[model samples]
Target: MALLVEVHVPLTPTPGLPPGEYPFPWIEQVEDFLVDLEEEGAAESCDEGTTFGDYFVFFLVGATEAGLLAASSRVAALKGVPAGSFALVTDTEAPEMGTGRRVGLPL
Candidate 1:
């Protein structure tokens, strides 16, 4: 049962850095953080193969709240990342358990 975790990371442009300068340093930092999670047993694997618009999406599998917190803390320390960026974790195997309400009644 693998979980689909969406980590929304807020990015900031650094001064003196050109638009195409490419912030590889900060990106490497994010990768390291994800790798640590995998090594710590908090995550099964971290997939770095997705791109979300301008920002990259790191798919963190088998994540917990504690693990999320640790990752967020490390990411927050980076210069180009903001403080409020979050890691959204959800079980991919779990179905939507919400109650369905009809919008319109039948005549």
Candidate 2:
């Protein structure tokens, strides 16, 4: 089966976080949320090339039969990621990601 992956690469830190530099300190909290998902076997991190823009360090999580975007979205709700800035995609249209329809955010 095609790997189910979720992208959670936000362009900026959540508004709740204090202003800081690029690769903002609050990014860690986001990763922590996803990593917790991974630890729970909800998803696994992927090393794929799907740059939304130019420079932004984020994760691409892949699950088994279903993409964990919904789970990640729920996590974002608790973690303070901006709802407007968030998005989700799957590999339904392409073997490589980034071509899926928008439903959701980064891993």
Candidate 3:
């Protein structure tokens, strides 16, 4: 079964992302990364309830530990993304994206 990975990216300036303003570009990068994962048969990002308030919240479905780890590495390495940006890994699927564990990027 696949797990739900909720990636949280900051929209305001922070220690991780120096000038976290360009939320659009950052989000586009994230979407592109998810597409890459899907093309590689790694994961699939669901875009039903994505939000853009204080930060960005998106949903990705993949395997367990390894999948989350790989995704984390990619997100952390993103151009404007910060290694401090984190993701919430859940055993459940979308819609109910339940509370699971918190893992830092580049894990």
lDDT comparing candidate 3 with the true structure: 0.67
Candidate 3, residues 28-48, lDDT tens digits: the string is: 777778888889877777665
lDDT accuracy of residue 17 in candidate 1: 72
The residue-by-residue lDDT of candidate 1 on 57-81, one tens digit each, is 5555665645644554555565655
> Which numbered prediction scores highest in lDDT against the true structure?
3
TM-score of each: 0.57, 0.58, 0.71
Candidate 2 structure, TM-score to reference: 0.58
By lDDT, highest first, what's the ranking? 3, 1, 2
* Poorly placed runs, candidate 1 (over 4 Å): 18-20, 77-80, 93-107
TM-score of 3: 0.71
In terms of TM-score, which candidate is stronger, 1 or 2?
2
lDDT of 2 by residue, 35-83 (tens): 7777877776555424466323343456643446665565557544444
